[model samples]
Target: MTLSVSLQHAFPGVSLDVRFDAPQGVTALFGRSGSGKTTVVNAVAGLLRPDQGRITLGDRVLFDAAQRQNLAPHRRRIGYVFQDARLFPHLSVRQNLLYGRWFAPKAARRAEFDRVIEMLGIAALLDRRPGLLSGGEKSRVALGRALLSEPDLLLMDEPLAALDEARKAEILPYLERLRDTFALPILYVSHSPAEVARLATTVVMLEAGQVTIAGPAHEVLADPTGARGFGQREAGALITARVSDRQEDGLTRLDCGAGPLWLPGITAPAGAALRLQILARDVMLARTRPEGISALNILEAEIQDIVAADGDGSAVLVRLQLAPGAGDKTAPEILLARITRRSVSALSLAPGLRVFAVIKSVAVAPGAVGPQAI
Candidate 1:
């Protein structure tokens, strides 16, 4: 299923003219603050009427300004998970979840209550009230309630924004499970590059009020000009990798376009496919392979392009394409490294020049690695 939206909304000084289709799996609305991420999601959920445009899921028309049709939010069959849990304080977890199921049409009740509880790992908290649960627990309960509603499309507006690091970590795995298991399309709003890198299959980036960029997660992140949207500090490349082996000294090996990579704190089992995020700031480049390097992971690549900051900043983002891993025939993947303009000049780095990308094994935190959503 796909969600097509074309919206035109004006808010005094800021106006939005946005359009995009959210395909199956998680489609993330990624951009800086005030980028209209929430506004677009709100329009799709029928929370607010756009000045003009149409919104459709499959053949159903949820909103059409020209036709004077505006479906009620309750009738739209879209599950919304806001930044806050928003569960009924007095109700137990089971009661809150069942409350959502009450709105489902009898014939369309496909998400069973027991299955949702198990999937969200909320069975233990069924009898507990929302007030008694931890932050992560509350988020899981809120998501479970939405799933129990049997929604055709799910809308998440910065669902993890309010959680602390621990809470965010605890809930991320459950969120991944939701995306992988659910066959319906999802519209997720997040401004964090790390979160977007973790969950998004398709990414639609909004800026001011317009769609600055939109495409598959890896392609969007690898866009050389994306620094303006994702910010220079957050620019990175998302690579598809498979766990080749688990090492003896607390490290995991992954096979990717960069060949074999060793990373710390990877808990996934061997043969598991996952996504890995490499921040530009974490990558160091060398014109030639050095012998006494302490970095465990080094890949041979050719410089594809170089992007210098628009202003006086000395930092530049150098794009590189790595050779495919052994027995891997897919196209080479892109990687980005941020180095000073002086370093670029000293190294004589330019497009088509071969170089060695030294990636610090410890720089990739456990949070930077996520399950492959496709």
Candidate 2:
């Protein structure tokens, strides 16, 4: 399934103009507060009508300003999970979930209740009231309710935003399972880069109400240009990798395009495909191979672009392209190096400069590694 949206909303000093394609799996709507990520999602959920826009989910037209077509939220076959779990205060978890099934047309109710319950691990909470559940449990129940309704597309507005770090960690794996099992399109909204990197199959980046970048999670989330769009401190790179071998010392080796990298943890299975994020600040660049370094990764790349951050003596952003001979030419696997202004001038760094991006093993985010290679 695919979602295409071209929406415009105006409210005095604030205006939102978002346009992007959200493919199947999870498409994360990411931006800082007031960047209009929620507005776009609300438009998709039919909670807010765009001043002018067209929204299509597969062949169904959810909204079209020119045609004056707007599907009510109930009729849109879209499920929305707010930051708050919003479960019924008086109802048991089972009853709350049953309420979702009540909204579906008889013939359209195809998602098995048992299946959804299992997928969300909410079976044990069936008899418990919302007040009796933990924060993560409530969110999982909310997700189960949404799935029970048999939605064609799911809209999660920072589902974990209200949870603490421990709660967020508790829920991420269930979400990964949901993403793998469901075929419906999902538009997940969040401001957290770690969450976006962990969950998004596609990323739509917004800035001041406009879409700054949109593409596969790895491509858009990791590109230096794309990272700069998020600001220097947030810029980084991501690579598709998987656990290839696990050492007894708890260090897991991941097979990446550049080479193997060892990181702490052996939770992921061997041969599962995983995506690894290499933060820009954690990377150091060298023109030639450096010796006796404690860092575990050094990917061969060529400088693709160079731009000053802000001030002359502050920092410079260097973009790199990996394996230039790859088959796809649109955008090669890219990496970013954020170096001091002094270093840029010292090396005369310029576009097309061949270099190695050294990444410290410890800097790689935990659970940021993708599934073991398939």
Residue pairs with colliding backbones in model 2 are 271-372, 271-373, 272-371, 272-372, 272-373, 273-371, 273-372, 274-370, 274-371, 275-370
* Cα shift from native, residue 293, model 1 (Å): 0.8
TM-score of each: 0.97, 0.93
Lowest lDDT block of 10, candidate 2: 323-332
Q: Estimate candidate 1's alpha-carbon lDDT, on a 0 to 1 scale.
A: 0.89
TM-score of 2: 0.93
Off by over 4 Å in 2: 310-313, 324-332, 372-374
RMSD of 1: 1.3
For residues 63-175, what per-residue lDDT tens digits would candidate 2 score against the true structure?
A: 99999999988889988899999999999999999998887779988759988888788888999999999999999999988888888899999999999999998899888
Model 1 C-alpha lDDT per residue in residues 1-374, reported as the tens digit of each score: 88999999999899999989998999999887898999899999998999999999999999999999999999999999999999999899999999989878899887488888888888899899998999999999999889888999999999999999999999999989999998999899998888888898989999899998888888888886665567777788988799988878988899886688999998889889988999998999998897797898899999998887446769888888997667778888999898999999999999999999999999988898998885
RMSD of 2: 2.6
- For candidate 1, the per-residue lDDT at 238 reads 88
Alpha carbon lDDT at 86, candidate 1:
98
Model 1 misplacement above 4 A: none
